[model samples]
Target: MSDVAGTLPSTRPSFLRLPYLRWGLVAIIQLFLIAIPLADRFDVQRNGQVVPLELVPVDPRDLLRGDYVIINLAINSLSKDLSEGDKIAVGDKIFVGLQAGAGKAAQPVVVSVERDNAGDLAMSGTVRSLTENEIRVDYGIDAFFLPEGEGRIIERLDTSRVLLEIAVTEDGRSLPLTLLVDGKAFQSDAAF
Candidate 1:
């Protein structure tokens, strides 16, 4: 306590000079090792990540490319048998499971071909709803216009959801006939 050469009174700021229960266990281990992977790479701009689906098609042209809702999700479709140059493009992230035997109408297939770290694999079955897709299955309006930007800004049209009319079955198989909304069939237990 007698060394005031350069007026050194520095007693805080070297990792908070530690020792307060080891700086609260180093701040909860730096919040799960560096703020949880930087909050999991911005987690798709977060806004309540929902994942319910069952709207095979009914968006004739939800205002086309602007009102957007061109989806495909039999639990998250991926039935590529391949033929038209074995498609899977549009930022491929192919890996949806179920098809080996598809016993109970099995659905949800696309077991592995990885590509979308976030590209969205043909809009990875867009989401943002929590109920009614026959009974829960989502990712609506493409994750609510992906962090909110396009999809015609959604223009507030989540009616009650059930707007499907999917089809990509040239072999990339994502075909789901229809399920209408402003046209009828409010839900007769239609699984596709």
Candidate 2:
């Protein structure tokens, strides 16, 4: 009762309110830190298809699996040549010619492949310096690379195992294109 009017009561906001602005600032900073480095990107092609992607190279917090490779597809990897020679036979250094179009790379076509004396498939030409039009490639499917029985958990050992030079036909124009595995292809899934 003695000068109680001069003193304030506890009816005001708590300490939590004061810290809300500071906490919010910290949260904003944290969000920016998390998002900035996530701006990296990549691209891939399958068959003659091109796949574009934007990704973060971090440990990758996934929706279900936690973390994994987000492979983007630029082409249908199963749609090889759109014609023939689907399998890489024994001792064949397959030659693949890339036709330009589907993506920034080539379209799709076949190049000459020869069997080396070591029983390896060797590419017969040169598109070694690839640009927008075409690329020549030697098949790395030789036994020395993949050995055959490793198609399960290891379909590709390195870029040499999966990278193939391909050619494609688009609107009567043939071009050379580079192709890669979108992963392995199963038979009869010929959306081809």
Candidate 3:
């Protein structure tokens, strides 16, 4: 009986017995989760079409959050007619068609509730407000972070000359890529 007690089979599951294997699986899963979004952003950056939008600069400073510019694009407000008679309500997802202007910058040409109707160079935005004459949309790329102490230089510049260059995928996903002030690239301190 004493020998049998000493040799009793262990009750713990096989996976539980190997702690390192279990932790390694957890670490792999965590790494996989982190890689997904990073890969998506990389894909957009690599494959998306570059579009430059004129900026409607607003006061861009947050005392607590460090230096960053609040980006307001000229396309934020569109003529109601651009909707092509589609009733756009607040909170509705809409696509705005764009046409290249004489300059490199693109201009909004039309708006539609259906992505297919928005043409090739369209951008996706959420309708923020609707009025009798105009529609306002939020494109989510509304903030550009600057290096420490650099916001002051941007704040003093004539914001009308600022342009935000964004890469927009066919599916309407957009990423802000560069800032141009007076037709020249504004060097950003952001690592990526």
Q: Pick the candidate with the highest TM-score.
A: 3
List ranges where model 1 is wrong by over 4 Å: 1-18, 28-34, 41-43, 46-72, 75-77, 81-192
Model 1 C-alpha lDDT per residue in residues 1-192, reported as the tens digit of each score: 776775887776676666896779878987779767445333432322212334443233433333334555455433334211233343433434333221122345333343232122222332222221111223233321112243332334553455443332211223333334554433221121
- What TM-score does each of the candidates earn? 0.26, 0.23, 0.85
Collision count of model 1: 26
Give per-residue CA lDDT, model 2, range 49-165, as digits (tens): 332111111122344433322222222221334324434333433443344343233333443343222112112322233323333332211111121333332332343233333
Instruction: State each model's CA lDDT, in order.
Output: 0.36, 0.32, 0.84
Report the lDDT tens digits of candidate 3 across residue range 127-146. Answer: 99988999999999888887
- Global lDDT of model 3: 0.84
* Model 1, C-alpha of 131: deviation from truth (Å): 30
Q: What's the candidate order when arranged by decreasing TM-score?
A: 3, 1, 2
Best by lDDT: 3
Query: lDDT value for candidate 2?
Result: 0.32
